[model samples]
Target: MSVGLVIRLIVLALLVAFLVSPQTFVFVFRPLVRAGQPVIYNQGSLIDLTLNHLAIVGTAMVLATALAVGLAILVTRPFGAEFLALSRSLANIGQTFPPVAVLALAVPVLGFGTAPTLVALFLYGLLPIFENTLTGLTNLPPTVTEAARGMGMTGRQRLMRVELPLALPVILAGIRLSTVIALATATIGSTVAARTLGEVIIAGLLSRNTAFVAQGGIIVGILAVLIYDGLSAIERMLMRRTGQAGRQA
Candidate 1:
């Protein structure tokens, strides 16, 4: 349909083709591999690795979004106002502690595989979404909220019909940021024996096979770009709708 949509589809097609038959691109990467090394990245199925990577990242994002948004909504309420600073500090913990550090600490408790990675990513993604949600909810025009209350709306009704609608654009921006970051960071899951594209990159690094690194990096980069663009489009659409509503009022 649209040019951007067509471009995204082409990228998705290329990614699928590459994952299904990575060796087909051997010529593109042959020069990058060591003299005696095979040009293809054959450690595992790229498709499976990509799917697993997406699943881990998606799970983390869902968890992060739920927690962050809920906490943001909580702190903005009168009953929870006093806990704003505490909530911020808690969200900041993930950013303060590196993913590697989180992973290392979690491995002992979670015992490897996807569990540790999920924890790390969930923590890492919390700050942006939480901060953005807080900003969106807190920054609404007082007049609009007052109007909703004047119309005999309950707190829940005002929040659902008035506050959240206006805040959706800003909240979506946070989600966009979180999702993009998670897509790239999920690669680190491979260190804990989680199947991910990071395995290819790590393998390349260990064996000095540039092809592996390049392919892994390319796929991750493409995925991030695609997701970022898609989320951005959604954010823009929401903003447009919000603007239209404002003008109508």
Candidate 2:
């Protein structure tokens, strides 16, 4: 139990405690509100909202990872090299348009709730994953790749066995970045009637209840920090496995 690990555990415990029995923590938030305003977000369960928020982020991440990583793989290969710029442009298009605008445009076609929110998140999250994967694959040590080639490995074999393994830490780093962005950005999904933690935030904003706002912000912040820390640990493990950690250190 390193100090960092201990701190993370404490944060995790606080989050669970808040979600499991929110009223118990009302005293903590009571100071932020007026006499009659509610301290807790009462319309929906915090656990349900958090789960819905995670579901939306997870789905969008899956879609974005598949397309972004696929395109990254394609453009890195000899046959697909010429299309590198095009792939970059395509990924950039997602980030170029704001999620709000994406949702607004998608609402007419995909309608409201989760569908449009998913579209917004998927597009908004693509660029980081794509760029990171591309950077990881392209910047691998020439000698390591040459050794793989010397071992009579096929292009696909080298990619699957050598390249991808070495590149995974970086790829994971990208996914981590994208996921964190999606987590926070998903809050806006409530504007389109999506079931997310954003609903609590929006309600607080609408009713001018600072306590509700603090509650929503705190939960989302805890989630983002935990997920980021978790992903960073995974990334570091992958780097060590691939010997990148030693080289970097």
Candidate 3:
């Protein structure tokens, strides 16, 4: 009945379909291909590819979040305010360059594997997080900061006990956006010899097998949706807790 319940159900369904009965996808994808063509992507296990894809996205997000949030915190401080413009420009550069181009340039040095894909995803996932974190930190109500100061809170104490808790929801929203972007973008990594669902899509493209492409695209789509929903549920929970705390205080 509730939105949270609906999201949990959707996430459960997706996980069951992908993990418990992957063969179910064969029937779904079969209609997209000719009768004689194989309906499943047989070159690599879909589960393995999915895991690898998650690994890539997860690792990149960790790096991106750390740097983006760290930079955002710095820029919001008086001493670091001057670096704000430069940080924005740096974060923008990542989104400006296409993942393919980043791969093209990185492959020469990283040489065709998960490393370059990680680099591309890391760069591609930075801007949204940085921008959102900056907005969250900078836009806090002046009254809240004054209250914290009045309570004899130091800058670090205010940030740790007051600001960060308040900013978490907005910061998480940014992470959610960046993560969804990375899920789709990570598929491009397969072009550089990285293990991803893009391998299935690319194979299908090469062989003209629509089913393979559909299977890969559908799985990625479902994953993105499920992950987005999961993150949203967490965000809503955090917001509710934050509100409850505010009311009690």
| Among all candidates shown, the one with the greatest TM-score | 2
Better candidate number, 2 or 3, judged by lDDT? 2
Best by lDDT: 2
List model 2 lDDT by residue over 43-90, tens digit each: 899999999999999999999999999999999999999999999998
In angstroms, the error of model 1 at 47 is 0.4
Please identify model 1 stretches exceeding 4 Å from their true place. Answer: 1-3, 244-249
Give lDDT: candidate 1, residue 157.
93
Q: Model 3 over residues 78-181: C-alpha lDDT tens digits?
A: 99999999999989878899999999999999899999999999999999999999988987878899999999999999999999998898899999999999
Q: Comparing 1 and 3 by lDDT, which wins? A: 1
Q: Would you estimate the TM-scores of all the predictions?
A: 0.94, 0.98, 0.92
TM-score of 3: 0.92
Q: Between candidates 2 and 3, which one is better according to TM-score? A: 2
Deviation in Å, model 3, residue 60 alpha carbon: 0.5
| Total colliding residue pairs, candidate 1 | 0
